[model samples]
Structures are given as C-alpha cells and as structure tokens.
Target: MLIFIILALIITILVIKKSKTKLQKTLNETVSNLNKTIREKDDIISELSKYQDIIDVQSKCDELLSNAQNEAELIKKRYETLLTFAQIEAEKIKEKSLSAKKQMDEQIKIRKVEYDNILSTALEQSKQIISDANIKAEEIAGDAYKALNNHKELEQKAKAMKNVIEGYGNKYIIPTHGILDELADDFGYAEAGIELKKSRQKSKFMVENGLAAKCDYVENNRKTTAINFVTDAFNGKVDTILSTVKSTNYGVLKQKITDSYILVNNLGEAFRNAVITPEYLQARLDELKWAVAAFELKEKEKEEQRLIKEQIREEERARRDYEKAIKEAAKEEEMLKKLMAKAQLQLQEANDQQKAEYESKLIDLQKKLQEAEEKNQRALSMAQQTKSGHVYIISNVGSFGEDVYKIGMTRRLDPLDRVKELGDASVPFTFDVHSMIFSDDAPKLETELHKIFNKNQVNKVNPKKEFFKVNIKDVKSQIEKMGIQSKWTMLAEAKEYRESLAIENEMKSSEEFAS
Candidate 1:
C-alpha cells in the first residue's frame, strides 16, 4: 500500500509542474492583447477631439457671415435714402431755374415793346419835319424868281433913253443920271448893266458846266451889287431928268426912271430873299420810276430765291430724315439677326411660350427691315439726283465774324439769287460775293475747295456746310491754284444793313432819353 502512495505522489508532482507552465503561456498572450487595445482607444479619442475643434470653427464663421449680412443690408438702405434725397434737391433747383428764366423772358419782352413804340414815334416826327422844310424852301424860291422878272422888264424901259443918247457915237459918256457926268459917274449905268449881264451869264455857265454847286455864293453877291447900282442910278436919274425936263423934253424919261426905282427896290428884296441851293445830283431814288421798278424786280427775285432755298432746305431735311431712318433700320436689322440666331439656339432648350415670342419678334423685324430698305433706295435716288450748281465764296463780317466765309454751291439760274437769299432774314447783313464759279462739275470743285480748307472747316461732318475759318488770302491762293478765273468783290456794300444799324442805334438813344 506504501509503495502505491509514493508512485501516486510522483505522478501528482509531474501533473502540477505541467499545469504551471500552461498558465504562464496564457498570461503572456493576455498582456499583449491588452496593450494593443489601449493604443487603439488613444487614437479614437484624438480623432474625436479634432472633430469637436472643427465644429467650433464652423459656428464662429457662421456668426461672422450673419453679422456682415446685417451690416450690408444697413448700408444698402442708407444709400437708397441718400439717392432719393439728392434727386428731390435736384428737382427743386431745376424748378427754381425755370421760374427765373420765365420771369427774365417776360421782362425782356416788355422792354422790347417799349423800344419799338419810341422808335416809331421818332421816325414819324423826323419825316414830317424834313417834308415841311423842303416845301417851304421851294415856295420861297418861286416868289423870288417872279419878283426878279418884273424888275427886269422895268429896268429895260428905263435904259432906252440912255441908249438913244448913246446912238450919236458917244461911247465914252458916263451917265449917273439921264444926263452925262464927267467926274461923278465913273461906274455908270452902262457898267452896272454890263456887270448884271455878266452875272447872269456866269450863272448860266455854272449850270451848263455841272458846277452849279459853286455858283450859289457868287450869284448871291452879284445880285446884291446889281440891285444897289440900279436903285442908286434910278434915284439920281429921276432928280436930274425931272429938273431938266423943261429944258430938253426928257420928261418921259423921269417917269420911266421913277418906275425903274420902284422896280429895282423890289428886285433887291427878291435877290435878298433868294437862297443858295445845292445841286440836284441826278434825282431822288424815289422819283426815278425806272430805278424803283428795278428795285421792285430785285425784291421779287429775292422772294423767288428764298422760296427756292426753302425748297432746298426741305429736301435736305427729308434726306437727313431718310438717312436716320436707314441707319435705325440697319441697326434694327442687325439686332434682329443676332436675336434670330439667339432664338434658334434657345429654341432647342426653351419652353414653348419663349420660342413663340422670339419667332414673332424676328418676323416683325424682317418686315420692318424690308420696308426700311425700300425707303432707303428711294432716298438714295433722290439724293443722287439732287442738282449741283455754281460754287460761291462769300463774306459777311456783320453776320459771321471776319475770316469766316461761306463756301457754298447753288443750282439756280442766277447765283446772285442764292447770295441774296443767304443775306435775307437769316443773316443780319448782306453777304458780299467774293467769288462765284459756275461749272458743270460744281460739286467736284466745291469738294476740292472744302478739302483745301479741311483743317479750318467750321462744320466738319457735313461737307455741304462749307463754312471755313481761314484767311481770305489763303482761300484766294487755293482758288488760283485750281486755275479758276473768278471775280473778287473786295468792297462790301452792305448799305441797307448799315443804315438799319444806324437807325437802330438812333432808336436806342431815343429810348434811353425817354427812360
């Protein structure tokens, strides 16, 4: 039994040792698995912290965006309010300006009416005064001439007695009275008569030689001397003849001498009344019937020319309107072409209503373009067929300042007609024609002239508006270079315009005085 116990104990000892070795192996494997699991838990905790940081940053960004949106809305509202206020202020200012302009225009109209009334009154007064003076002067001259004729007839009879005494070949006899005087009557009746005759002859000569203007003063003095001499001789002769009537039968001569004395006194009065007159150079413009008729004809021609110019202006206006229409049509056509292309592209992706609207617009544009093309053709034909005429270079310093000239062409029978038309109401003064060149190719010549003055052209776009600001010398040089023969009217006879200005100034002065 003891031996069996020892063998069992040994077997138990072996079993115990094997069991301890197995337990050690299991403990090592469990420790390794625990370390790996702890490392994985640390990695997951780090990833979760990173996600929490991301969430915090997103919340701050959203808060900043919300604040910015609120600020932007505040700024937009302020800007709109400010814009509205500015517009209201602008409207108030515009209203005030318009009101002020209206008030000023009304004042100007009142002043103009007052000025017109003053001018009319002054003109009427001046005309009446001039007419009265002329009429009075003529009447005085007529009375003086009638008195002088009566004096002449009486003096002739008084001199007959002297002639009979001198018929006995006593040419040297000097007579102060009807009888001869040796010492006293050196400047006697015959000498006085000769002087009077010479004065009459001189007056006649002056009129014949176109020097009547000079004869007035000379004739006045001569008439005075003649009257004095005849009166003195008649008084002396009456005394001598009356005393010697019984001794020599010269009583009839005394009566004749008395009549001559009275007549001579009347002649002296007549001569004193006579006035020196100016030479009637030709006749007054109004009195010359033919001249008045010619002026009327010129005025009628001007009216005709003005009508022609109006027609031309109408045609030009029509042409410009047509050109504008054509340009608009072309623009519309191009826009339609683009729209049609866009519509076709959009039609592929567009809804039904949008496609139909685009199609309608395209069809309408096509119809409008066709109509525009037809109108353009008509306008182009009319413009092309417009008649070209003489090219005129003209100047009006009063209308356009010096060195500003109008270089234009006209298709009229008379180029002067065009010049007159330009010088009408449109311009304050008449334009003096510097040159009028009539040519079959007037348009070409005009174009050439415009090109020469391209740098100095006043209106650049329209070659038809051929106004140039250049020295006349340069224009003349260019004209010469073109080998065109033209006349230059250097003198500007703006008579009517100048007179009108003078009248205007006079009226202005009168207005000032009245005010």
Candidate 2:
C-alpha cells in the first residue's frame, strides 16, 4: 500500500511540472503577443495603429501634398501678373521715345527754314548795296575827272594869254579906237579878234587900244526920199535945194520945219562929224563943193522972178479980156458947165477914196512902228549891260536935235568932264548920255531914223533955237521934270511915242477902223 501511494505522487508532480512549464510558455507567448499587440497597437495601433498609424500617417501626408499643390498654383498666378505689368511699362516707354523723336524733327525743320530765309535776305541786301556803291563811286570819279579837266583848260588859257601879251602891236593891231566896233560888226568878232575876250589878245601888247560903239542915224520919212529922187530927176535944175540936203543926214536938222536953208547947216555939220578919215575925207569935201556950185546957179533964176513982179498993170487988164472972150463962146459955156458938175462929183469920190487910203495907210504904219519899237527895246537893254574890264563912250550928237552940236558925251574921265563938255557944246546941263547905239551896219541905223522922221521935217528942227522943234523941247522937258539919267532918251522917246498911239486910240479918233 505504501508503494502505490508513491507512484501516484510522482505522476502528479510530473503533471504539475508539465503544466507549469506550459503555463509559463503560454505566459511568455501572451507577453510576447501583448508586446506584439501593444507594438502592433502601437504598431497595429502601430500596425492597426501602425495600420491606423499608417492610415493616420497617409492622411497627414495627403494633407501635406494638397497644401503644397495650393502653394504652387498661387506662385504661378503671381508670375503671370508680373509679366503683364512689365509689358505695359515697356509699351509706355516706346511711345514716349517716339514722341520725343517727332518733336526733335519738327525743331530741325523750323531751324532750316529760318536759316534759309536769313541767307536769302542777306544775299539780296548785299547785292543792292554793292550796286549802289558802284554807282556812287562812278559819279564821284566822273565829277573829279571833270574838275581836273577844267582846271587844266584854265591853266592852258592863262598861259596862252601871257604868251600873246609878249607879242608886238603895230603890224598886228590898229591904233584907232573909233573903228573897233565897226571892225567887229564887219568881222563878226571883237577888236581883239575874239568875241568873248574882254582884254583884246592884242591889247596886252597894244596899250591904249580899245573901241567905242558905233551907231547909225536915219531920217524918218518918205518925202525925204522923194525929194532926193526929185533932185536926181532935175539934175542941176534945183541944185540950190540939193546943196543943203544929203541922202544920209538923219533926224531933225533944221531950226524950223518950214526953213528952206536949215538943211544946209545940217548937211555941213554931218559932214564934219562923220567918220571920214584920210581915205575918203578929201573926196567927200570935193563932192560937197560941186553941190554948192550947182545950188548957186539955181538960186539966180529965183532972183530974176522977184525983179519982174512990178510990170504987171497992163498984163492984168489983158488977162481979164482974154478970160471974158473964153466965157462968151456957146460951146465953151455948155462944156464948162458940164465939166464943173462932173468935177464936183469927182471931188466927192476922191475925198472918199482918200479917207479909205488914209485909214489903210495908218493901220500899216502902226504895225511897222510896233515892230521897230521892239527891236529898239532889245538894243537899249544890250547897251545898259556893260562888259567887264571895258569902258564905253556913248553920244547924242548932230543938228538932228536942236543945234549943230553934240547932245551928250561920256569919257572915262568923270561926270564933271561930261558936264564941262556938254556945256561947251550948248547941250542942256540936264542932258544925260543916252546909249551907244551899236550896229553891225551903219545903213540900218540910217534907215531906222528915216522911218521915224521925215527928212525935210528933220532938217527944219533947230536944236539950239527952236521954232517948232517938238522932239528937242520934249527931251529937255523930260530931263528937267522926270529926272531920268539916261542919255538914250531919243530911243526911249520914240518907243513911248509909239506906245501912246495904240490901235484903240486910233479907232476912237477915226470914223473907219479895222474890226
């Protein structure tokens, strides 16, 4: 019985030991599984946790990736905005640059235009100034040249004058002065052979050489010519009248207009004063003597007529008887009555014809007188104006006035000399020198004088003793009252006389006048 109990105990110990070992093994497996579970939990928790953790870790990763995608998209949007703004800024810069270039181009065009206008104006002004300067310079030079030439010409003339003065006179120049103007009148030159030359080219060598103006005197009339013609017609028949008169005597030369012998003294005076020189002086005297001899023969016939005048007592009775016999004839009485009536009618016709002729002649005379008066005016003006470096001698001469005397005379001496000479010549103290009546032809003055006065009437004037010397008396009156200093009163008086007799006055006085 003891042994059975030991075997059972052994079996129980063994089973217990095996069970302990298994339980320990299970505990280790549970611990390891728990560790694995915890790790898994951690892992599961971790695995499941891990799977959950993996799921959790995957969720966290997905969240992180989504956030990154959102950030990238934002970056892309910002880049696009930057690019658009940059493009806008660049476009604005380009436009501004183009505007600046356009402005610069416009300024260049304006500057060019202004420069061109300025250049053109400058050129035009320069050209005008040059042309004007050339014209001015040319004028100045021309004037200068003309002045130089004039100076040279003056010098040459002065030199020539000096040389001419050195020459001699007698053969080259005449000593006489009275013939100087006459020579000039004929030669168409002055005494010096030069027209404008005052100092004769010969005068420089020829001292006291000069000339007086030569004037002419003519009787104003038609009867003078007729009387001259009558003397020629009658030859020696009326030599008494011819001896006292001459073809050349001018102005009033007689004391009275009716004086028959007054012409004698006038003819003699004219002969003495006339320029008769040595050449013709002798011939003139001989001619005058022959005229005187013829006059003596004619005077004898008149003396015989005066002596036979007393023996006419019986002749007067006989003349009455003869006249009665003529009246008694029947045929003679009838013819006488018819003739007397015809003569009366003829006388009336003749008177009417004479009136018409006188009117026509008066008109012609007036026109001729006016023309002559104008020529005299010009001549008088020339006389008053004197040439330089020259002395003039003027005279109012001859019996053509009141006396056979010189009315006026002027010398280079003085006024007192002239007065003395006038007093000596029986000229009035108031008488002044008239003009130096200069003429190229002596006949022209003589002709003009005849146109003014009738030759027979001229011879009747007495210059010293007046009977009807109207012209001489008038001259004296003018000198006394008018206080005129000119000796050329003869010319002036004639002009005044003509003007006073205008057509208006003539028409008033006459019954018939030209319209």
Question: What's the C-alpha lDDT at position 251 in model 2?
Answer: 15
- State each model's CA lDDT, in order: 0.63, 0.42
C-alpha TM-scores of all predictions? 0.25, 0.15
lDDT of 1 at 55: 90
Q: Model 1: residues >4 Å from true position, as ranges?
A: 1-388, 461-463, 508-515
Worst 10 residues of 2 by lDDT: 249-258
